[model samples]
Target: MSVNNKTVWLTGASSGIGLALARQLANQGARLILTSRREQQLEELRQSLPNSEQHQVLALDLNQPEKAKETASAALKNTPVDILINNAGVSQRSPAMETDLTVYRTLMEVDYFSVVALNQVVLADMVKRRNGHIVTVSSVAGKVGTKLRSGYSGAKFAVIGYMDCLRAEMAEHNVRCTTVLPGFVHTQIAHNALTGDGSLRGKEDQDNASGISPEQCAADIIRAIESNKAEVISGKGMSKVAPLLQRFFPGLLRKMLANR
Candidate 1:
């Protein structure tokens, strides 16, 4: 299950964990198909990598879920995809009561439906080949709901459930599925997070600012993929403990989150 020489289609490649994962995967001799809304940034990233000529870029907005199938077809036209990384997602920092329904719909479209749409396209090919991997970047919020992240958490939770079912279904096809639950890596996610009115928060959260580096998170994710793991949780401190607390001590975890 080494990714060496494997062709990986990675989304959200312009920044944050996606960017770090691209660098690490490139170093492993994996040919990448990088996608994001920023074509210029994707080109810059490609030029910065070793063997830059070996990689490809396909810029598109995942917000438009209807286009994902077409995008996936174009991506696979050049190379048979050995792995598909569903990492493009949006975050939210608003209470459920105040947030507009459109905001929740937008988040679900980008974070959940888009992944499913893209996967539906690529997965058929993988089943035909009987060899491929689907890696999704979920969140700790998917495991434990928290304040100010209702929409974001709901979307992530859907991802977890979908991936779980996908893993079971793909098991017979020998196509691996790995769900990555990252706590909080130091990235632009918080700054780009949507507010109640669907406007960007434009301010980084203190917790995210003090979180683990994206490089470290990328390394952990790569390792998980290589190991053919079903799931991997990456983060530090309470982020690592929150899931456990929620599973074993729900009452205590609920009280703690309530007081936060």
Candidate 2:
């Protein structure tokens, strides 16, 4: 599970935890194929990495789930992907009752279906090679329900469930699956979060502003990958406690979340 010299295909590599992971993985000598919606930003990130020429950039819009298979195929054509990181996702900051149906659809498309689509595209190759790793970035919301995040929580929950099943299935194949449930990390996710009407929230949440750094999250994620952990929850303080509480005391956790 050593990342050194492994070919890692990472989505959402333009910013946030993805960017931090790209930098860290590059430093660890992992060849990278970076993807996101912003080609310019990906190119800039490539130039900033330790071995700029060793990495490749393929700008992708995960929102377009139909193109995921083709996109993944192209990436595979260039180089066999030893690791596939599904990190491209969006967040929501609206009450479920008031949120538009389109919002839910969009969230599911980008956060859940797209991951499945791309994973399917590369899975056969991984099975054939008998060596591959699949890592997904989920959210604490996936572990527990919270107010103002109905769609976001649902999509992330699906990701966790999907990865869990994939892990069990891939075990005999020697392929590993790691699901990362990150609490409120300091990222632009809040600013870009969808509102009730499907418009961007454009405001940073107080908790997110004070959450763990993306670099720390990325480092923890790399450790989880190397260890081949089934799941890892990364965050600080209460963010770390929330999942434990949810697993041990559901009624109490529900009440606590209701007050949030």
Candidate 3:
């Protein structure tokens, strides 16, 4: 789908990939509705965008399942979303056996359920109008199991499954769904990820600090949307090899990851 002048809603727009995409789409002439938990950052992002009134900032907590439809409705008050970028997500890093149930709940709410809820809200309208694109920002973890990323992988895998099903359901309706699996992007996700204590991790992971930039990730996402791709994977090393390794040598991959 062409992004020119399209109305798009991007969640988690305060920073990282969402912020990068907001800037790119805004420059491409798309009307944007940006949402995140940080109003101040969202305001700052709004200032950097091209369109003033055409773009809006709504601070929202994706942890609240009921808030998904409400937030979408609020955004619709400003303009219809021709594209929904379900980018807001939380990550968790701990031994799955040691991970707290609370962290699991929070991860599921923010990373999986919230996206599903918001999609349901906008789907009816899109189906009726027969023109819409849903771009879900998942991760390479969605396709391969990795150590210290059980919850994160679970949520992203759920997104891939749901979007795959949604694609089949919407095939005859003229709606498009694209799931993007980025390997690792230079974003605040690692710092923002929930720790064992239900607090954000204070330190950045080695991989996150040395990963691809969000601008590069966003460019790939935009290209995938333009092509209406069902799925697109980004990054070099682990990004390219993980899927192949998972498919052909699952036991070896598991052992390799454990050693890492």
Candidate 4:
């Protein structure tokens, strides 16, 4: 599961944890394929990495699942993706009651279906090679549901289940699947989250503003991968506490979340 010297394909490479991961992975000597909608930003990221010439930028819009899969599958023809980190996703900031149905679908498209699409595209090669690792960046919201996040939670929860099932079937093929639940990291996720009417939230949440840095989150994830962990929760304080409460004291957790 070590990323060192492996070929890693990462999505959401333009910013946040994905960007942090790109730097760390490249520093670890992994050849990289950086994917995101921001081609210019991805190019800048590539230039900033160590041994910059070793990495590549493949601009992809996860919103377009079929095109993304096709593009990634074509890249597979030239190079193998030893580690596929499905990190490109959007969040939601509207209540389930207020959320538009289309908003939910949009969340599913970017946060769940897109992950599935990319995984399927790369997994065929992994199974054939009998080697590979899939690291999906899910969220703490998926673990402990709260107000104004039904769509986001649903999509994140869906991906966790999908990766788990994928892990089960891929076990025989020796491919690994690791689901990472990261709490409110200081990223643009909140700012870019969808509102009830399908517009951007355009504001950072208080929790996000005070959360762990993306670099810290990325470092923890890299450690999880190297250790071959099945699941890892990356964060501090409430991020580390809520899930425990959810599993051991659901009623209390529900009451607490209702007030948030």
Candidate 5:
């Protein structure tokens, strides 16, 4: 579906891919309900748009899955969510064994549970209307596991599966579900990812540092949404060959990673 003049609710809108998408959507005449934990950043982004005053920003933490329904309800009060972009997520930098339980749980809450919760809350309305689009932002890691990203990959895979199932179920209802699997977009996700504890990882992966920009990622995502594509893989490293190598040529992939 075309994005123009649609009421779209985008989470993680304070920065990175979400922020870039908000800008692009605003320019294209869409009304957006921007959400994130940083109200200041949201406000700044709100002003960056064309008719800056027209956009809306709601500050809410996605870690609290229970709050998703309430947040959706509030957003729908002004404008019903015709399009829901589940772009809010976090990552991890350590292996499952080394990462604290709290860290993993937090990642699960944001990357998986909250997205599911929000989708559940908004879906009934969309189904009743028999029209809507839901875009879920997954990672390339969702398709293939990697070292130091065990928890992150697990959560991404779970969300991807959930979205896939939801898409299958919603096919008859005119609601489209598209899962965007990006390899590495030059976003601040690494900066916000959890370390061993609750602290931010505060470091960008070398590959991510050299990855695609959030603007480019947003553009590709918009194209996918327009075409109602079920799945999309962005970035060079997200190729089908990457997963193939992970399965059959694990040793070679490991050596390549070691060299990186």
Candidate 6:
């Protein structure tokens, strides 16, 4: 689908990939509804994009998915969202044994449930119109498991399953569901990752430090959406090849992960 003139509702738009995507979509002539908990940052980002005044800002916490679902769905009921990008999420940096149950719950709520909720809000409209795209930002972790990401990977993996099913269902409706599995992008995700105790890690991972730029990731994602690709992977490190390896060399991949 052409991004030009499309009304894209983007979450997590205050920073990182979402921020970069907002800029690119605006430059491509799309109107946007930028969402994030940081109202000030969202407004600032909206203004910096092209056709700034034409965009909308609706700051809401995805952590509170119920409220977000209600508010966002309400906003779109009359707005006709041509695209919905489920990019709002949190991350984790702890193993299953060490991570608190609450931490896992938080990850599931923010990373999995919230994406479903927001997508549900937009699905009806898209199905009715029979012309819309839903791009969800999962992670390369979704395709493979590793250390320090049990909860995060679990949620991401769930997203893959959910979006895969959605893609199949939406195909007949002429609605596209493209799941993007990005690896470690150079974003604050690592620094903001939840630890074992459900507290922020507040430190950057070496993987993220060396990962692809958010702008680059966003561009790739935009291309995937435009092409209606079912799935696309981005970023650096083993993320690029882990899925292939897992499929062809499961035991080797497991052994390699164990050593990491």
* Candidates 2 and 5 compared by lDDT, better number: 2
**CA lDDT scores, all candidates in order:** 0.93, 0.91, 0.87, 0.91, 0.86, 0.90
TM-score of 4: 0.98
The candidate maximizing lDDT is: 1
TM-score for candidate 5, please give it: 0.92
Give Cα distance to truth, residue 223, candidate 6, Å: 0.5
Q: CA RMSD for every model?
A: 0.9, 1.0, 1.3, 1.0, 2.2, 1.0
lDDT of 1 by residue, 1-260 (tens): 99899999999999999999999999999999999899999999999998999999888888888886787676576467899999988999998899999999999999999999888868887999999999999999999999999999999999999999999999999999999999978999999999999999999999999999999999999999999999999999999889999999999999999999
For model 5 the local lDDT of residue 120 reads: 82
Count the clashes in each prediction: 0, 0, 0, 0, 0, 0
Q: List the candidates' TM-scores in order.
A: 0.98, 0.98, 0.96, 0.98, 0.92, 0.98
lDDT of 3: 0.87
For candidate 3, write residues 1-260 as lDDT tens digits.
78988988899888889989999999999988888888898888898788777788778889996875786676575366799999988887788888888888889899999988888878988998898999999999999978888888999999899999999999999999999999888888998888776888867898877889999999999999999999999876876679889999999988988898
- Answer with 3 or 5, whichever has the higher lDDT: 3
Per-residue lDDT tens digits of candidate 5, residues 145-227? 77788888989999989998999999999999999988778888888778776688888877788888899899999999999
TM-score of 3: 0.96
Where does candidate 4 clash, by residue pair? Answer: none
Write down the worst ten-residue block by lDDT for model 6: 234-243
lDDT of 6 by residue, 1-260 (tens): 88999999999998789989998999999999999899999988988888888999998888878898999877777898899999988888887788888898989988999898898888898899888999999998898989989998999999999999998888899999899989889999998899999889999988888999999999999999888899999876677889899999999999999998
- Give residue 16's error in model 4 in angstroms: 0.6
Model 5, C-alpha of 19: deviation from truth (Å): 1.0
Positional deviation of residue 100's Cα in model 2 after best superposition, in angstroms: 0.7
